[model samples]
Target: MNVAAIETVPLFEYLEFEFLLEYDVFAPCDRGRTRVHEPPELFQGFLHCYYEDVYGTRPVTRELQKPLVWFSCGFDRPPSRDAVDRFLTDLEHVVDDVFDHLVE
Candidate 1:
């Protein structure tokens, strides 16, 4: 957990994430040891991008340093732009499902 993110987690600590965890959001993907971001965390990260008007991995990485976004992603530590690219790319096929799931 990042210190900056930890400082402000209480605001969302009570938030329920059970809904997002109900399904294996990444079941369609071939993720193995490289799975870093989970569904709940990705949902939170997507919300951050939606509100922040930041799109794409590079853009998301720029905003990832923000305390709220950092907390949303549940990141253990700030990741590099390349790492973000890889993570998002790995989950790219499910991006549509992610948005659809959100609307339902």
Candidate 2:
């Protein structure tokens, strides 16, 4: 994820405070010795990526927003290195396109 993009807006602006707090509290315990690590900042980027993937340019209606929040909070399991690598590699392109749309 691009630091410049991330710094432009606070992550909590997009995510609920309770959700971020819960993850901050539990992530260490839940991810006991996982080789594929995701920092909180990177995870925020993933959430944004997933959100854009699902919602496209449409306004995030309440019905559509709930599932994205649920999915982001519930996806706590550690993925395999191969899976993480693959997803992140693909995510770069997705994020680029998302940013392109945002700029336009």
Candidate 3:
């Protein structure tokens, strides 16, 4: 049987940080809730994972921790898996719109 293959694109090639920052969907932290990472940054990370075809907080977190990934994304260091997970959870209510916006 012949094997099929797909090409891989370099991470962040067409995905500029400024582009992700253009979307202002993330809501401000509620009175009792506190966020360790900035909303835009986390959302950018979320989108980065999407474009790179990476899924889940664990893999995303790992991908983000690559030596220069954080610096390139404007973070001093990558956020923990827990932080990524929390960011994902927090966006559950509005994530569909966010994805729709990306499509458009």
Alpha-carbon lDDT of model 3: 0.63
Clashes found in each candidate (C-alpha, N, C closer than 3 A): 0, 0, 0
Candidate 1 lDDT over 1-104, as tens digits, reads: 45454333453465544464445544435645554555556555655665657898778878877755675568766566766676576457666765676567
Candidates sorted on TM-score, descending = 3, 1, 2
lDDT per residue for candidate 3 within 45-104, as digits (tens), equals 666667678998789999879645555555667898888887788678666766676567
Ranking by lDDT: 3, 1, 2
C-alpha lDDT of all candidate models, in order: 0.60, 0.40, 0.63
- What are the TM-scores, per candidate, against the unseen true structure? 0.55, 0.29, 0.62
Candidate 2: residue pairs that collide: none
Off by over 4 Å in 3: 1-33, 100-104
User: Cα deviation in Å at residue 97, candidate 3?
Assistant: 2.7
Q: Candidate 2: lDDT of 37? A: 37
Residue 47, model 2, lDDT: 56
